[model samples]
Target: MRQQSSPHLSRGFSSYGCALALAALVALAACSKKEAAAPAPRPVVASIVHPDGQALQAGSLPGEVQARYSTPLSFRVGGKIIERRVRLGDTVKNGEIVALLDPADAQKNAASAQAQLDAAQHNLVYAQQQLERDKAQAKENLIAPAQLEQTTNAYASALAQRDQAQQQAALAKNQLQYTTLVAGHAGVITAEQADTGQNVSAGQAVYNLAWSGDVDVLCDVPESALAAFAVGQNASVTLAALPGRKFSARVRELSPAADQQSRTWRARLTLAQPGPDVRLGMTADVTPAVPLATAAAQHGLFTLPATALFHEGRQPAVWVVRAADNTLELRRVTVTRYDERTIVVSEGLKDGESVVLQGVHTVSAGEKVRAIAPLHPEDFAS
Candidate 1:
């Protein structure tokens, strides 16, 4: 090609093109400057306020109304139900007739027993006369002593038969009395199964009666919460049907034994005035009384949702303020008490420090997070 083509000349020309292209790219990229990463989303705002010293998280539990006296209906003898004197919703007094059983067979047996007793007594009297005659003959040496003794034994056997017959008659009379059923207490009849002429076995229930006595609300508190209950303790009861009325009550009994299936103990609360308006089987609310967990003078105690609590091994800890930086702190807390809704934090928190009350599952100790207020301000109390 021409005089030794200038290598530097061609190389410089290629380098100049490459530099021009790179400069164009730099200018275009500057013009495009990528939008600043979208500012992080803001957390939802919440309303929080300081609580009063006397404020409390009043918790409630579901319970049922119950009668203090629940009695079973039964009969002493088996027979066909001839007449039913009472039905469900019947008001009855002590000794009132509830039902009647067929007494034909019983009466017949009783009459037969009496006949047997009379016959045995007559035979006994005749045997005694014969024994006396034989003894007198023995005294006159007309009969042998063995013969008199035989007559004496005959009289004794007849007397024994008479006594047994008499007892049988008495038992028959008692069985006949069972034919007329009677109420054992003043109560309102809750059920009646036996109808006229229905065959019933002994001790069969004919009526369900709820006796008049101290009414109560029975609540089965779980064994885990039973230790706080005792006899004579105070309770607050509310009826489901009557919304406004609340009856004060006293604990009648706290069963020491736990139910086999539910693992709960029965707590009986006697209502102060379970008015005539109250009915059996109606549902109620029973709240166990708790003593002041801390000093009554306490003010502004920390509170949190139970889910906000996380465990480190077996120790209970909560997320709290750590340092001047906005970092989460795993503050160990002494949890004194809790209800179904909220947990009571007794220690390890101060009044003004922010505590994570919710959404603790995503955050961890020393991690950075936005602090927000609780869902329900009323949940926290002093």
Candidate 2:
């Protein structure tokens, strides 16, 4: 026999079942509604347009300090170096002897030349006296004409010998003088290649003398920047040896052709009143003056963060926000210059226009965006 349930209990069970079904239907509808809703506006960082007017960019390059005029001193005659009077970095005056060679051989040669000249002179004198007697006898017809003619020829030969001997003696004297190497100009000794007891050949470098008056900073520039640098342009130089000091230099020379090895044009800058601190061969840093981009930028030009630049079919473009609806529009821009952190725009949008500086690639054309204040550039300074 089966037991039957009460009427109230059955009614309660049916009501519970209906409530659970209704709850399930409500939750499903709520989930479907949430999934159908539109997404929030895309957030982007942007900056207001500000021209680079009057702002100059500086380009720096490594350089070396050197004398405008340098001389390599060498001996005119080869000999063993007996004495070296000057050392490296020694100050020398004009006509000062810097080195001496072994003068034994030179002195002997000079003496030998002198003896030959004396003998030649005596022979010439004797021949002249004989010629005079011969001429007198010939005039009086006391001797044969052939004999007189022979005496005349002898006198001419002696004269020629005397002249040759004189030239040899002069050369010997010059050789003697050349044994002592002297400085032709007053300057600081930059290098010494020979020492005492060292035998150097003629025309071999013995010392390098650098004039201390004018100084130049030498640097190389690439072909792309050759047009920006001229002979008269001004620049600032900093030396590695002298910290906390800056020197002004004017461009003195710019090579017209590029170097075969470096493919760079050499530039020399003349420093203004360089002090003693500016030593030869010192390393230097040259900061050349950069001209303004264009005269049209006097009014205004746009400069954006490098991240804002995007390529569109080989052309650089930027995402500009439309003022009316805050929608992004891809605008083609002409880039004047580009650096590591910034891009200078010469022609593009108008002044006061806002462009996306960050997250440029994430957004698309005609997409609604929420503009946010861009971070100050200084915040990322490192």
Candidate 3:
């Protein structure tokens, strides 16, 4: 009986040992499968960073060509327009008639004024004759002193009346002349507000004239780009209508206050030598150049698409590619400016360093990645 009990005990112990070993083998297989199923390196678009001077130049701002001196031509007197001599974009000389108004009313007014002046002159002459006769009678003791004084007073009153009538006549004549709308300066008619057979009030604009002198490029600049521009600063202008041509311009005026609606300041750049081809209303591009000695250039500024920026706990960072093992490293960058489509980084990056351009959020530090050029290379163009 003792021997039989020992054999059973030994078999039980062996069975328990086998069960534990089987469990260990299953756990080992599971571990191996998990390792095999691990994710591979992610493919991400990237670009090699270079110190971009054009980024510091602030790119280009859309603008329009305009005249430095634009004035609205209007009639000085109210009347019905009879004819419009100039159309839109017509060049006119100084004092050239651009439009004419119905002069019938003005003619009647002038005639009435002339008639009044003639009557006043006749009255003045009659008063002077009566005063002289009274004076002669008084000297001969045939007229009372009060009567002679009255006659002299009448003569003085008549002279004043004649002078007033003369002024009225002159004013009427000028009003008749004012019926004709003339260009105050040599300019191009940029807009025509009133045409023939239209009634316009006095001082109502009939045409918008852009003086043919200095041409300007007008652009609206946002607050972010305002620092790059200053009055009298030099810039370059390119027109879409006139392709392949670049005009030199200088900052002439910058609005002190920003526009309420657009939050942009109006900037006017005067062309140094604008040709006749640089007509008003032509679409233009204004690019302000950055000097090489600027702080941004000195610090090696780089521009990247806005997608490349990542945030780590509110701190701006980027994913840098490690060349040794094709791994990613999160690097904090000093952002100089945030534009609509790009980010300007001033520090924490070296020239020729590979940086992930897109899908920055999907990457993590120490993760292996495959770096490739962006599909749209134009997006990275300086």
Tens-place lDDT digits, model 2, residues 288-353? 675333322443456577888887889999999998999999999998666567776778878678
Model 2 clashing residue pairs (backbone): 51-301
The per-residue C-alpha lDDT of model 3 at residue 204 equals: 91
Q: Of the pair 1 and 2, which is ahead by TM-score?
A: 1
Q: List TM-score per model, in order.
A: 0.62, 0.61, 0.64
For candidate 3, give the lDDT of residue 198: 87
lDDT of 3 by residue, 153-252 (tens): 9999999999999999999999999998888899898898987898899989999999989998999975446655678788899999989988899989
Best by TM-score: 3
lDDT score for candidate 2 against the true structure: 0.84
Candidate 1's C-alpha runs over 4 A off are 1-58, 242-244, 260-262, 291-382
Candidate 2, position 230, lDDT: 76
- Model 3's TM-score against the true structure: 0.64
List, residue by residue over 21-75, the lDDT tens digit for candidate 1: 9999998887666533334423422223222222334344467787799787778
Better of 2 and 3 by TM-score: 3
> Residue 151: error of model 3 in Å?
1.4
Superposed Cα deviation of residue 4, candidate 3 (Å)? 18
